[model samples]
Target: MSQFIQLHLLTSYPPANLNRDDMGRPKTAKMGGVDRLRISSQSLKRAWRTSEMFKSAIDGHLGTRTKKLGIEIYKKFTEGKVAEKEAIEWAKSIAGVFGKLKGKDSGNADAAEEKETKKKKGKESDKNPLLTLEIEQLAHISPGEWDAVMDLVDKCISEKRAPKLEELELMRKPEKAVDIALFGRMLTKNSRDVSIVEFGEDAACQVSHAISVHPVVIEDDYFTAVDDLNKHEEDAGAAHIGERGFAAALFYTYICINKDLLIENLGDNKKLAAQTISALTETAIKVSPTGMQNSHASRAYASYVLAEKGEQQPRSLSVAFLKPIESRKYDDDSIAAIKKHQENMDKVYGSCADFRYSLNAITGEGTMKELLEFVTK
Candidate 1:
């Protein structure tokens, strides 16, 4: 098996906002001394991980990433007909393991003297505490950890005792979920004694933020929505008018997978590791981030994909586009130039990679089966 697998993809998105910035405009980054439309690695990862293809391939192995974990725990306990108060307490306990929680029932004391006095007397304060409990940060929990927490809650309730802190701490070491293994998590402010291995394992995959191969000019599509209630012909003006940012460009995306790390993350399950890579690749090709998709529907697939398998140090072919692919008269497309540049650079750099496979849409060459076989084996 190869030590590393690298995928190089070129996909063209039409006018759409697959990723947005703080201003609600399409994201852009400066590359090659010019502005290029960008799709953040975060956006791409989430889209692929949550896509139907990924879910179908790795169902029950995905993690839930959210701060509303109290709700999940509460629901399970409540379904078992556990006392509402008891369930809330146990749920909060489990939630606390992931992060600090705040709520009316939470034992936290505020700075106010009156609240402190109320807490001292074991009395409720005049100000109502928040009904909902929330974690300080979003927690990524695997299904296995969730099950463990549920079982622990049941055991404690049956024993008619409050959960022990030591018991709750066990949840910190969850079975790694596929998405967590690939992207990893960092609990910088964790208050628990969980080891690095128990919390955020090192990410086995590195994804470069997808950037346009050429410079891009952001354009606005001014649109309006007409209200159906305005039936009269004299009601000519639209009900709402807004402008949205959009762009069209061929994007270059690169991703590298560390085989050994991935296997370790999956608890030494080599078969699951291969399935994960297959699912990830398929999702990347089939899924486009659904940002303003209802309006623009910018669905696209990779036009060209060059996959490499090697034991040598991994490298990206992005330098081929460092100068930005230019539009040429004889060869209008940048694919040829990008491919040529990669070949030339590899030759100059000792062709560090051991094996390579390619799939191009234009010539209808290269097989996905062969690519998958090479990467997995």
Candidate 2:
């Protein structure tokens, strides 16, 4: 049997430009200089999203049901069952309150969205597993913050005329997002036993905080890592890398894959699976000639295609890291490196019949062998 493997699907985002000055050095006065990169959970998730692996991991869980989420909503909207005005209002009410609800309702938000589809689809949609709010993630906000935000949201829908989804999203700013309830809220569900900052300093935890506060900042270790949200697109430091908005946030939804089951299925095919895992992870991200996406060199440093997958395919779970490829900057050398890794993945997956991005999912849409049989429960 091959040893075990662990894939830690991860992403990093930066906070507002590190309060820089004309010289570009971090502005420092009283408290201390700010961090160079403000990594956030949203940014990390966006990075994770780019990976075919994350998509597959979750798809394996959702199976064909994955596609149904969006389809169900679209289908409902088209059916005229949900009033455009009402739906828009719902979105609006969701937005302002979303900031605080960001943690507690994160998981449920998904389910809530799914629930709407069921209402539209009727009983047919009821049986499938639907996306729910990721309370674990949302609970990161402070309880006071959470209650305040939710109250505000209730007023928006309960009182405010139909709200705009676009408008609502803006209300949920990340400024106070790191308050105890939102960052890692699930960690201190009891609340009574919690402290000022409940979590110990895990690298991921620190990285997520920086990203949440400043969505446009990237690490200095990478060239032009800055995507300053401060910029109006004209602003030199406008949102960069993980800091980019929802488009960036969308990528954070990667599923951690269990490797032990994979090797067991592989049997004599273990080597093939191992190589594919390495290659897919290798190409976890690709950097184009433009923007700061994944650089090939990152493959070596947990950079290009940072992988959390264990070296061996064990029942253990893991994730693959991906880098940005658009709207960011990367060096010429970095571009070349990513190409090689991507090519490696193409060949590896092409040869492996059982392995696929959706392998872990029960839906047939998932190509990953792990998911071919499961259905949304």
Candidate number of the best TM-score: 1
Provide TM-scores for the models. Answer: 0.86, 0.23
Residue pairs in candidate 1 whose N, alpha carbon or C atoms collide under 3 angstroms: none
lDDT of each: 0.78, 0.30
Q: Which tens-of-lDDT digit does each residue in 1-377 have in candidate 2? A: 32332232223222223223354432222112222232233444334334565445433211110112222332333354555555433432332232221122223446778567546544532343222211122323323334444454455445544444443334432222211211122322223212122221111121222111112233343334554345555566623443221112112212233343443333333443444344333333321111233322222112212223233332211111133333333322233333344346547754211232322111222232232222110
- Candidate 1 Cα lDDT to native: 0.78
Off by over 4 Å in 2: 1-3, 6-42, 51-258, 261-276, 285-377
What are the C-alpha RMSDs, in order, of all predicted structures?
4.7, 19.1
Stretches of candidate 1 exceeding 4 Å from the true structure: 75-89, 102-132, 172-175, 188-198, 231-234, 328-333
Error of 2 at 320 (Å): 22
